[model samples]
Target: MVIFSVLYPATPGGRFDQAYYDDVHIPLVKEAFAATGLKDVQVFKGLSAPDGGPAPFVAMVHLAFEDAAAMQASLAGPRGAEVSGDIVNFSDITPIAQVSARD
Candidate 1:
């Protein structure tokens, strides 16, 4: 499986509406990518670092796909724009994305 992770950094003055992200954005993502081999979605909300400092990211989302091809196909399709464009509805921080293969 391939995991696509989107990480939102914690920045001063950044805005994040966790409630909207949880209630609206996630459902939108699931709906948009359901047919493109999307298997599961998981979200993580940051609390603090090991030293009790600000967390590096305010939130992170992991999208699991059957394979890299499926991921690419989904993102390259029309729904990708819809999902990506919805970011503004929740947070202003630009997300850092990474793809990883399960060990």
Candidate 2:
């Protein structure tokens, strides 16, 4: 599987509206990539580290696509623009993203 991941760092006093991410942003992502071979989506809310320390990140997202091409398409064109533009509505922390290939 090829996955696109966007991770929000846990910055001191940073703002991340989890409610908006779950209620609104996620749904928007779904609709935008529905036709781009989006297979599934997994959203993670960082709670704590193994030692119970602060989590390194506040949120993480994994979006599964059919392949590299499909993943690329998901981040291109008009739909991609919509997804990128929606970030400011929810959080202020810049997300770290990557594309990975998994077995």
Candidate 3:
């Protein structure tokens, strides 16, 4: 399987309305990707940093697919466009994305 992971750092003085994200944005993304050939997805919030260090206050999102081609296909699909539209509402800063293969 292929995995896409993202780390989204919020802007300085950032304020996130969790209720909206959990209720609206998350569902929208799930539903949108459902239209595509979405295999699996995972979302997480930064609660604490390792070694008690300061965390980045990031939202970590992970998407799983059958392969790189499946991931690309989903991104190029119409539902991908819809999910992309909601990105701006989540964070003010750009995210870091990477792909990995299962061992």
Mark the regions of model 2 whose C-alpha exceeds 4 Å error after superposition. Answer: none
User: How good is model 3 by TM-score?
Assistant: 0.81
lDDT assessment of candidate 2: 0.92
Model 2 weakest 10-residue run by lDDT: 69-78
Task: Give the clashing pairs for model 3.
Answer: none
lDDT to native, each model: 0.94, 0.92, 0.73
What tens digits encode model 3's per-residue C-alpha lDDT throughout 1-103?
A: 8887777775577655566667787788677665555577788877767887667855777887778887887777877787777777755567788988885
Better of 2 and 3 by TM-score: 2
Q: Top model by lDDT, which number?
A: 1
Residue 78 alpha-carbon offset, candidate 1, angstroms: 1.7
What is the Å distance of residue 88 in model 1 from its true position?
A: 0.9
lDDT (C-alpha) at residue 69 in model 3: 83
- Identify the runs in model 3 with alpha carbons over 4 angstroms from their true place: none
- Model 1 Cα lDDT, one tens digit per residue, 1-103: 9999999999899999999999999999999998998999999999999999989899999999999999998888889999999999999998999999985
Residue 52 miss distance in model 3 (angstroms) = 1.4
